[model samples]
Structure formats: structure tokens, C-alpha cells
Target chain A: MNQFNIDIEHTGDYAVIRSDGYINNLGGEKISEECCRLLESGCRNFILNLEKSPIVNSIGVSILIELIERVLESDGKLVFTNLTSTIAKTFRIMGLLQYAGAFPDELTALDEIKKM
Target chain B: MTVQEIKEIMLTVPMIPDMELAVTKTVESLSRFIPFTGDQVDEVKHAIIEACMNAFEHSRSADCRILLVFKVGPCKLTVEIVDHGKGFDPALVEDPKIENKLFKNVRKRGWGLKLMKHLMDEVDIVSNRNGTVVRMVKYADAYRKEALNESV
Candidate 1:
């Protein structure tokens, strides 16, 4: 099944990527590409909305790490919002939580990013 | 002693990352018949994804295939993922948890094996000149008890 897609929305200084599917290799690649595209457009801050994505593999997590690195290189911040409990736990185990912050909703994430 | 239904499923898929969804979904569907809690099901799905992804990534052969065998018994569920590719010793692989540098990097790979071992009740990896088979098991009774205790 084609169980991965993303929609990008620009809000002032950052872009929110709403991902709708399992975040595996396919989903991860799409997210990385979208983030890179946005980075080139001078959008450094990012809020990744993952409420629709309940599952993510290590490959997908690795891809997210790459995005985090890219954002850090640009002195930008990448935050995660609307994470399922499973994904949140996985991210914590993989050390993604150390490099990024996760909020319960997108508005909170956006508010935090705006302050940064 | 208790008598419980036993069910088995066999699935074969190409060695590609995108096929992970199909494998996970099939396992989730079959797990409904068993007594897996929501947390247990998530753990099972994560472990299965890692096994399948490892097979697809490590198997350099263009025509490599992955075989999944799932067996559900009275109190436990076991899944075996077999891949036809060059295998490495699981013992030789360093634990990502022990290696603090790996966790610090965040981008460092090798979390797959660690996660599979952590999520499942038991994990066995057998690799030889033929191929590698990763067998993982989860105990329904244990998780069910944990869930029940949490609700208490």
C-alpha cells in the first residue's frame, strides 16, 4: 500500500510538514527531500506533525536525524508535534529527543519555534 | 492446563524497504486473533519492521527475498524472519547503548538490533553461510498482566 505522503505549510519563519502514513524508508526519503527543499528556500525552523503517523522504523528515524543535523547546521531548530506514544518512545530510545523537542500539538510547537 | 488455539502464517516478500508496510500490516492483522495489547502490538510491529528492514538493507543480492513465519500459541507469539544473504555474527556487533558515542551522534546506525532485542521478550539470531534468521517472541500473558496491573 502507498502508506506515506507529506504536505508542507509555511508559517512565517518556519514550515510545518504534516506527514500522513508510516514513516519507513519511503516516508523518510520524502520527508528528507521536503525538508531540504524548504531549507533551500531559507526556511530553517521546522515543525514536523506526525499525529497521522503512528509507526516509524529506524531508517525513518535516521532520516529525521539527518534533517535535524541540517537544521542545526543552519542554526535552525526542528521540533516534532503530535507524536503518538509509540513514536515518542522510539524517538526517545534512538536519542532523537536529545537533539529535538516534541510537543503534544502543533500550536505549542509553533509557539516554541516562534520564540526561538 | 489450558488449551488454546494455535495459528501460523507464512509470508514472502521482496527485499525492499517499501514492503515493510505490508509485512507489518499482515502481522498486525494476524495478531488480533492472539491476545496482544495495544502496546504489545506496537512493540511487535516495531520489531518486525526492524527485522524486515535489516534483511532488505544487508542483503546485497539483487534478487534477495525475505521469508516471515509467524506462529501464535496459547501465551506467546513468535516471528521468524529469514533472509538469503551474507550474514554477520550478532555477537560481534557492539551494543549501541554501551557505546555512548553512537547515541550522541543520533545519525549513527545500528539501533535496529538493539530495538528488536529490547521490544521482544526473546530474540535469537542465527547466521551462517546460507543466510540469517532472526527469531523474535513476545509473551501475551506478560504484557496482559502488565496492562492489567497498570489499570489497577
Candidate 2:
């Protein structure tokens, strides 16, 4: 309900980050910072749940792209779950789909990430 | 009352953080009268936000103001975002690809126009030294068509 809020849950194998509210520059930076901290902790696989954060701008998405590149550099995996139609299409248009995966929910995304 | 009336709204907000949400709030009100579906509404909000962010980040307007006009017609919505700042040529903006953004060194903040174009049915940009105007349209006709097919 805030302008932006991020909640991260670390499972044994991967992490699930739930994002809520509009994703602008500040929101993106927050997400990036969290992902960095997770990466430093040796959590490579990630499933980002965006159900509560349906609205996003290009700047925020660009930061996601940056995160994708950084994770790929480490041979880590990233997937998105609970994305709206527009978000999925935007990812496709921006070619993020080529590097990451998008599923209907966290369980599906987790299944996919495990195979990666 | 013989002719169809077009519902319209004009709003002005300062170029600051989170002002785009104000414009989208107006859009939500308009969508109630229009025929846009949930997906279409999300696309419109996203496109509008991108436009506002582009101006907020690059326009550097003296007054730091953004002007938005929403015109609602039959099965169509047209939005124009204007900023009275030094503008650049839209043709000169480099098309960003994920390949380059992923492997090579580049800034990742220039995907605004691309997003607006893809999300809207039509998009036209006019820019000069005085200001910039981004006019975009989203038609509800496609939704209507799908609904009609479903009913058939």
C-alpha cells in the first residue's frame, strides 16, 4: 500500500521477492539493491512476484534488465511470476524473455528455475 | 444533443516524483466511461507513465510542468503529454536492444518511446527547441470486436 514495498523470502534453494506498488526509478533502485544483497549472500536463483506491482515504467524495467544482466554474468537464474499481460509483453518486446522466464505463479516459476 | 459529445480532461502537474500517478488516476476515471478492458487500461497507464518520466528526466523545463490532455471518443481514447522544455529529435534516439544492453556498456533509461509506441494503437511525437508533445491513442474497438465474437 505504500508507494513501494519489497518483501524477500529466502527458501533453501532460491529466493522470492514480492514487489508492491508503482515501479519507478526509486522502486527499481530498491529492487536492485535487494537483489545485490541476495547475490552477495550466494543466492543465485530468483523468482520475482509482481502481482501486487502491476504498474511499471520503462525506468523500472530498465533496472530489471540491469539485474538480469548482472545475474546472468554469475550464471544465476532469474524468473518472473504473477506478471500482468502488459508486463509480460513489455518483457518480450525488450527481449528480456530470451534471458529470463515468466510463469503464472511462483510455484511454476520455481519449477522452471529449478530446471535452469 | 443531436451530435455526439467528446468527453475530455486537461491536467497540469509539476515535473516531480510520482506525478504520473495523478494523470493515471484521471485516466482511471475516464476508463469507467470508455470501453477499454483491464489489459488496455494497464497499457495506457504504463505508456502515460513512461511519457511523464521521459519528460521529468530529460526535459529540464524551466517551469517543470507537464500537461496532459485526455479525450474520450466513441471506443477510442487519445492522450497528449506535453512539456515545455528543450526537446530533442525523436528520430535520433537510438533503438535499445537487450543484446546491447546486456553485453555492452550502455545506459538503460531510454526505453520510454519504445514502450509508448508498442502499448498504444497510434503514437506521434513532435519536438522542437520550445517543447515536446507526445500524442497517443488507444482504441477499444478491438475489445468490442472480441466481445461481439464471443456473443456470436
Candidate 3:
């Protein structure tokens, strides 16, 4: 099984990152690094599709929070899509849902971001 | 080993990277006997990860080892993560907030214990100069009550 990998696709103004595998510290850093590249290129909207990568530790989730801070500082939007209920609940408990938007899937997040 | 001994799995892992994953793999094997739902197993795995990470992060074990025990009970599965390292006061650990961590220069990585406590049904922490052991329990769902009873 793939330990951690990311497939980034830029659709119009938003970027969709499909993650496959466990979101450990390294996996989290990969997502953050990819987002950093997108941010530098002036992409403001992000859709993190974690349909395949559902499991995450606090360290990895903590990195996502830091990413949210960076994205917010840049006046950009960061949203998560296709989160397992376990991850959704974990996000809620960690107060991540407050900082970042969560949608059911990539299409929904992209549509919502387009509306914004 | 008796049948009772077979139900209890003890693992000792070095304090290295990705050791938590090893524990999770063993946990998956244990699921054959315990009817953990998809969500419950994920919660258990995540809690185990947090507990192991806590040992690696805070304990600073001189021996660089973590001892884990998985016990199958009548209605619950108990996971114990033990470390022989310098322990800190859980009371002193600050509760991290996104609001405080985002804009301000505060720490944002103290959610391990909170996540473990939230994921597991019950969490007990015993820490001192000797070591720290995080004991987490997950009660089986009512869907398969007799399965566990018959197995144990």
C-alpha cells in the first residue's frame, strides 16, 4: 500500500490535492509543501480531497492547522473534502472545522469556492 | 501459553519513526477476534498513534523504547502504551487552541492527549519520574456482544 502520496490538480482558480495513504508528519508536510507552491503562484482556493487518505495523527493534523493559518494570513481559503467521519469528528474536536471549510467531496468544495 | 495469554498481545518498539504504524498493523490483526466497527478500529488506531507519539515527543525515553499491551476483555479492548522515560505533569500541559496558535506565537502540537482521550472510551494516564503509561479502553459495540464473550 502507498504510505503517503499526493496528486495535485489545478482547476481554474482552485487546486485539488488528492491524498492517498496515512497522513503522518511527512505526509502532512507534503501537502503543506504543495500548498506552499500553489500559494506562491497566487492560487487562493484549495480543496484537499482526502478520500483515500483518511487516517491521520495529531502531528499531521496539527500541520494542517498551521497550513490553515498560513492560508488565512494570505487571505486565501482552505477546505477539506471527502473526510472520513472519524477524521471529521477529530477535526471538530481539534477546532479545525472552525478555521477551514469541509465539504462532502471535491465537487462540492469547488462549487462552494466558486460561489465565494 | 494459555488461551488467556493468547488474547493479550505485548509489543516493544524502538522510539523511531513510523513505529506507531507497526502497532496499528498488529492492532489490525487483533481485530479478527474483536468486532471493532470501521469507525471504532480507526479511532483505536488513531488513539494508539497519539499515545505512541506522546511517548516519542514528551517522554524522551533514555532507552528509546515503548512497550504496548493489547488485552481483550469481556466487553472492552484495553491498549497500554508505556515508556520508561522522564515524565511531565499532564496538568502543566497547555491546551492548544487554533485561535491562540494561529496568529500568536504559541505552541500548537499538544493535542495528542486530547485526541487520545476523545477517541478512546476511557483514558487513564499515570506519569512520574519512573515512566508514563497511557491506558486507553474501547468498549465493543453492541452489535456483536456475544462474539467477544465467546472468544474470551
Candidate 4:
């Protein structure tokens, strides 16, 4: 399948990336590329909307890890919003909840990002 | 096997279009017997994709092929994925209850094994001197019941 479809939008310091479809190894590559694209545009804060994305493979998870690392390394932050229960569990199990923040709703995530 | 059957079925292919089908037609033949819902089919597809990609990405070989064999019986469906790469530790795969925190160091990526275990009723990984093969099974009735309960 075509990894994932990415949509980019900006608000203040945060760059929101909305992705749908299977996020596997190929998906990870695309996400990484998009993260790089926004970083080049000088946007650091990120909110990843995975609500529409019901499934995520380990490779995709790894990419998210790398993205989180990238953000943390740059002294920024990454948040996940609108996550399906399964994907949310995967992230939680993978220890993503420690470094990254997850919001029950997008407005909440956006609100938190505004405060940051 | 029958070339005709292989051609007619949805065989697994690598992410790359140009290469020969990364998995064999036998793989699909085996899948026919395994009982899967639309959702399960998607999960198996994702699991296979992750496993094959691990072989293709981590190993040196560029054009390697992974073989998937599906054996469907009256009550159960079994999938066997064989790869031509050096195997790693299955122990390293993370537990799903480890809390919501990313592990630092990132010495290895092994959540794929964990995914397989969660998706399949039974998962067995055998990595020896002769490459690696991961086997998974799903029961038709049990899956249906669980899926029904979840939907309700």
C-alpha cells in the first residue's frame, strides 16, 4: 500500500501533520521526510494526528520514535492527538507516552501547544 | 503449484513494484484456508509487511525474497514466513504494558515480533543456522467471537 497520506498545516510554532493509511517502514520514511520538510521550514513544535490511522506497523513506530528524538534533540516537543485505542496502546507500550504527550482531542492538543 | 491459482490470487509483493514478488504464490494458497475478517486480513498484511521489510532493510542483500506459506484447515489458519537474513533476539521485543514512554538507546527495533504475537493466536519464531521462519496461527471461531465482542 502507499504508506500514508500526509497533510501539513501550521499554527504558531507547531506544525500539524495529519496522516492516514498504513504506517509501516515505507510510511515511516514518508513521515520522516515530512518532518524534515517542516524542520527546513523552521517549524519545530508538532502534533501528529493519527485518529484516522487505525493501524501502525513497528517500522512506522520506529519512525515516530525518530521523529520524537529529532524534536527533543532540537529542544522542541511532539504530541499525538486523535489516536485510535489500538495505535495509542502501541505507542504507550513502546514507551512513547513518556517523552511525548497525548491529548484526547485535537483542540486540547492545540491548546496545550499554544501554551508551550 | 498451479501458476493459474497464483496469478488469480492477491499475492504478497515487496513495497517496490519492479522486483519479483517477494513472497511465493504458496503464501496465498495457505492464506485461503485461514479464517480472517476484513480487519484481520489487514492486520496480517501489515504484519507480513513489517517482517519482510525488516529482512530487506537490515540485511545486506537487496533482492532477497521472503516466503509465506498459508495452511488452512477446518478450524484454523496457519501462516509461516521464512526469511533469508540473520535473525535477531525475539526477547528484545517490548511488552505492550510497559507504560507510555519511549525507550532511549534504541539499540534495536523488535516491536514487529510483538505485533505478530498480538495479532495471531499462536506465534513461533525459529532462528537457527538455517535462516529464520516465523509461524503464526489464528482460529476462525475464536477470532469471530472476539471480534464480535469488541464491536459490541
Candidate 5:
């Protein structure tokens, strides 16, 4: 199986993490670590693009919840862009949508984050 | 139709996190033989992964193994995930949505069992000191109804 990976890009005042592959334990941990590293570097706003990741288990969702908490603790916002319908529904059921917002695309997410 | 074509795939892997991808992919591949819609396939994939994760989390020993059995029938798909772990009562898991509101920071631990039950048409769990087996089923008739509703 191919291991999951993330590519980070810093744009203006925010950072974006483009994740690929299944977001399980390995992938989730990597994403969390990357987000924390960015957070430490004074990057408060983040947009996570999960377009390449089609599968995510509960463990992965937990990792995302932790990231959301971390971002909120820093008084920043985390948004998800390009979510599959399945993942969108999963997030709704898991109550992540209540705290974090999801946009249709990266540009829309960036637009919303910039306004915040 | 004559006798229903039945296909089976059995896998035993160590209780680890990364193995979930392979297990879910195998389930996805086996489900292709059935007449499930795209959404149905996703639901089955999610449910199996949840079951396997539960097994990984609750297994007794570090070297414990998880068993996944996929049984495909003409009209139904059945998955059984077995684990040699100390089992807990499923009744103890409160509804995540309700819990989400009561707790300040929403929890991530309790959503797996609820999701498995919601996604699959049928679910059965049997656990004891020996091991745990989670059986999940999805029927083609449900998809037929969905197709009918979509066309209507």
C-alpha cells in the first residue's frame, strides 16, 4: 500500500496542506505533525485540501478534530476544501462541521479565510 | 437466476493502523462483484474500516492478529471481522451527536461503532473472553430501491 503524504504551501498569511492517499493512522499523524510545525512557525490560518484522499477512517477523523482544536486554541481557523460527499457527511455526523467550515474548492476556502 | 454466485476472501493481518487501507481496498474490490451503487460501495468500505479499527484498538496482545472475511452473494454482501481482544459492551457507547454537544471539545473515540451501524444495512457483534466478530451486511434490494427513487 502507498503511504499517505502531504505537501505544504505558504501563501500570504495562511498555509495549505494538500494531502494524498488514505487518511488513516499514518496519514492523520503526518497531517497533525505538519499542522503543528506550521503553527509553531506563526502560521495560524490553514486550509486542508483532502481532494486526493478518498478514504478516511475514524482514527483519521480524530486526528482532524485534534488539529481543529489546536487551530482554535491559537485563535486561528481551519477549513477543509474539496471534500468528497462521503467525507462531508462523515464530518457532519462526527460534528466536525459545527466547529470547522468546508468550502467547495481551495479558492473559495482561501477567500473565506482571508475575510476572517 | 440459478444458484447465486458466492465468492469469499479471507485475510489475517497484524493489529496495526496502516493495514486498514489494504483491508478496505480488498473489501472494495470484492464489492465490485456485486451490484451496489457507488454510494453503497463507499458505505461498505467505511463500515469495514471502522470494524477493523475497533479490532485493532481492543485486541489483547501486541502480536494479536485481525481476521477479515468478505462473503459476496448474488443479492447481498457480508463482512466478518474477527479479533482476539478483550471485548466491551457496545451499549456503553453513547450517541456521538448528543455527546458532541455536552462535551466542549467533541470526542473522536466513540464515532466508529455508530458509523458502522449507520452505514450498513445490518450489523451484528459477538464478543467474549475468546474474541470478537463483527458481521455487517448490505443488500442489493436496497440499492434497487434507491435507483427506483432516483429515477422517479
Candidate 6:
């Protein structure tokens, strides 16, 4: 099993966390840590691109929910871009849409965040 | 004859060996009926592995065997994962959507179940009466359309 890869890229005002591989318990923790590190660096806007990632378990999902809460608490917004349909549905059922928003592609998510 | 021709298949494996690969291939083979795409297949496989691993670790059986039965129908595919252990309560499990991070550790066992429910069309479990039987169903429509475009 390959641990998920997280790449942090900053474009002026927004930061993107591009993840690849299975998002299980370990992957979830890694993602959470990365998000926290970015927040500490004064980068609040986030766009998670899960296009290369195929499967994400509940652990990953919970970590995402935590990220969403943390972002909201700091008046920052988190958007998920390029979600696989299964993940999109999972986010929906988990009611993540109530707090976080999703876009079909990364560019759109970035645009949405800029507008906010 | 293809995987679609088969009705049911039973697999019993010792919990000591990590059964993730076996369950992944088995479920992928049955994708003919469920019509899951490569990505959907991966999601389902991960969920099953998590469920089985939980049984292998937390369940009270020292040397227990896990039984996975698959039933393939014309319109749906169903899987029953059974373990002879102390069993758990499905109703008591909290929703993973809640922001309470405190509950994550306590309900770590049910994480697989939650993903299974989210990935599959239906998920039902019977616990305590005769151990735990996790039932997962995937509709043909979910896979058939995708199958037409991709090789299963």
C-alpha cells in the first residue's frame, strides 16, 4: 500500500494540497498535519485536489471534516476540487457540503475562493 | 462463462494473514455484476479490507476464521462478511460526519462500515445474535453502464 503523497503549492493568495494514493488512517493523519502546517504559515485558503487519489476511507473523511471545521473557525474557506464521484457522494452523505464546498475542477475551486 | 454467470462464491481465510489483497481481487472479479468502475472498485475493496482488518484485530477470537460470501444476481451483487467474535452494536455507532474528534478513536472499528455504506447502495449489519454479518449491495445499473465503456 502506497502512502498518499501531499504536495503543497502556493499561487499568490491560495494554497493547494494535491494528494495521491489511498487516504486511509495514516494518510488522513498526514493530510491533517499538512493542513495544520499550512494554516500556521498564514495560508488560509485551501483547495484539495483528489484527482489522482482513488479511494478514501472514513478516516480520511473525518480528517477532512476536521480540516473544514478548523478552516471555518479561522474565517478561511476550504474547497475540494476534482473529486472522484464516489468521494463526492461520500462528502454529500456526510453533509460536508454544509461547511465545505466542492468544485468539478481545481481552477473553478480557486476562482470560488478568490471571490470569497 | 464469465463472472456474471456465477451466482455465489464462498471464501474462508484465516484472519492472521492480511486478507486485503484476496478480498480486493475477489470483489474486482465480481465487478461484472455490480458494474463498479475501476475507481469505484478501489473504494469498495478498501472498505472491505478495513472491515476484515477490524475483525482480525479487535475481535476476541484468538484464532478465528473470517468468511466472505458473495451472491451475484442479474441486477445486483451482495456480499456478506461474517466473523465469529464478540460482535458490536450498529445503532450505537456515531455518525462520522459529526465534528466530535473524540468519537473517532472509540468508533474506529465502524469506520469501514461507514465507508461501505457510503460506497455501496445499501449496508446492513446484524450483530451479537450470531456475531457480525456485514451486508453490502451494489446495483447493476451502478456498474452496467460503466462496464459498457470499460473492460471488466
User: lDDT score, residue A52, model 2?
Assistant: 95
Q: Best by lDDT, which number? A: 2
Candidate 3: segments with Cα more than 4 A from true spot: B1-6, B143-152
Runs with alpha carbons beyond 4 Å of true place in candidate 2: B1-5, B143-152
TM-score of chain A of each: 0.95, 0.95, 0.95, 0.92, 0.96, 0.94
Given candidate 6, what's the lDDT at residue A69? 74
Our model 4 lands, by Cα RMSD against the true structure, at: 6.6
lDDT (tens digit, per residue) of candidate 3 on A45-84: 8999999987898888888888888898998899999999
Give the per-residue lDDT of model 1 (tens digit) for A1-116.
66688999986669999999988767888999999888898989999999888888987787787778778888889999998777887887777888789999989998888777
lDDT by residue for model 2 (B29-54), tens: 89887778999998999899989999
| Clash count per candidate | 0, 0, 0, 8, 0, 1
Report each candidate's C-alpha RMSD, comma-separated, in the order given.
4.2, 3.9, 3.8, 6.6, 4.0, 5.7
lDDT of each: 0.82, 0.87, 0.85, 0.65, 0.81, 0.73
TM-score for all models, in order of appearance: 0.85, 0.93, 0.91, 0.66, 0.85, 0.78
* Docking class for candidate 5: medium
Q: For residue A90, what is the lDDT in candidate 2?
A: 86
Q: Write the per-residue lDDT of candidate 6 for residues A22-72, one digit (tens) a residue.
A: 776677778789888888878888898888876666666767777777777
Candidate 5 on B16-130: residue-level lDDT in tens?
Answer: 6577767877877887788787878887888888888888787674457888887888667888898877877777767776335433655556678888887887888888777
Order the candidates by lDDT, highest first: 2, 3, 1, 5, 6, 4
**lDDT tens digits, residues A1-116, model 2?**
23799999998758999999888778889998999899998999889999999888888888998998898897899999999999998888888899989999999898788776
Residue A51 error, candidate 2, Å: 0.8
Please give the lDDT score for candidate 3: 0.85
User: Candidate 5: deviation at residue A55, Å?
Assistant: 1.6
Give the C-alpha miss distance for residue A9 in model 3, angstroms: 0.7
Better of 1 and 4 by lDDT: 1
